[model samples]
Target: MAENYVLRTQRLLSKLPFSSWLFGKVISRRAPYFGTITPRITQVIPGKCECLIRKRRGVENHIGTVHVIAIANGLEMAMGTMAEASIPRHLRWIPKGMTLDYTAKAGSDIRCVAEVDQSAWQVGDMPVTVTALDDNDTVVVKGSINLWISEKPSK
Candidate 1:
């Protein structure tokens, strides 16, 4: 399983021209504890990122439904992962804050898609919203993450 993740990361690196920051995000992401899970980043065009997660027992709550927090975390992951990929290498970003809305019950597996339409990224602060949806296409959770961007060392 871990080997598959590594291979996927390598495949992403080969296709996306990612910097070390992007590489690190994929490498450091904690996926194992969530059970037999797979995160596939399906799209990364300009200001958008789309990812999907298959629901497993580890992501289920006591009610046999997808846990709210788990879906929320996945939403955050989609947003932050997009930010890491969209932001230039000479800038650093961190999640300064976030807000979530648990609008519906997630009964099945989930997909998270996050997007920001900013043309150019400058050093400063910004907010991006990531959303997670259930198999029926209802929003399970929406997370708005505050990002702080700072200048990085000149290369």
Candidate 2:
């Protein structure tokens, strides 16, 4: 059988120079809204994923800080990639909802991370922990993204 798409894509892109940028570009093409923050998908592995978004004018709010919504987009991207890379081939998953809290101001570039325990994959609702951290490693946003995991329909 072919490799999982998310895992395969990450492996292929990491072989190239500026792989993070290229990978994010490719993903944004597949999900156009993620392009709004110009994220760089730095990692996508089973159980975890990381995405980085620079502190740029486009993502800045009126107060000259990275907008919370932009950070949210990054978080969702990381969660989706992590789920896709980690889930068993027999399973399928989709986002059900998200609950986020803005804990601190995002004063610098942000790194969004999504993580799930290896044993957490099952046929049910799972809460994936996600966080957006500033360059100083301060948690600016903390949340859990709810995902519905189920057995894939028989072909």
Candidate 3:
């Protein structure tokens, strides 16, 4: 059976003292765009993932608030992690598209949580919901990422 890289990495890093930092480095190497937001995966399990991104100058907008794109990038990272951990080894997936709504100004560090249902594992389009919350625990952004799931080709 193919190993779930996301789950394997999460398990290995959980034993380290600086797991978050090392996880960020691993992600940065795998997905460079996610590095722009400096996301740290806090939790990962089948069907759910959570990540945190500090509000830094690099992610600031013209008005000094967190840029919308930065939040979106964080959300995408969360969704990708969830998908990677949840999908069966015989299946493959790709993000088809995303829809987002900015409800408030993200004035502080943000946490993005993404989740999916067992029904979403089928071969077809699946919509996964991802929500971003500020330090105060207020929802700042909400979105759904559509992923295309299909059986992996015979090796």
lDDT, model 1, position 13: 83
lDDT of candidate 1 at residue 122, scale 0 to 100: 76
| Candidate 1 residue-wise lDDT, 1-155, digit = tens | 12233345545585565433344356346544332334555565446766666677877889888887777666666675677557765677888888888888888778888888665477777778688888888888886777888898677
Question: In model 1, what lDDT does residue 73 have?
Answer: 62
Q: Put the candidates in lDDT order, highest first.
A: 2, 3, 1
Considering TM-score, which of the candidate structures 2 and 3 is the better prediction for this target?
A: 2
Alpha carbon deviation, residue 41, candidate 1 (Å): 2.1
Most lDDT-accurate candidate: 2
The C-alpha local distance difference test score for the whole of candidate 2 amounts to 0.93
State each model's CA lDDT, in order: 0.67, 0.93, 0.90
Can you tell me which runs of candidate 1 are displaced by over 4 Å? 1-37
The TM-scores of all predictions, comma-separated, are 0.73, 0.96, 0.95
For candidate 3, the clash count comes to 0
Ranking by TM-score: 2, 3, 1
**Which regions in candidate 2 have their CA more than 4 angstroms from the true location?**
none
Identify the leading candidate in terms of TM-score: 2
Steric clashes per prediction: 0, 0, 0
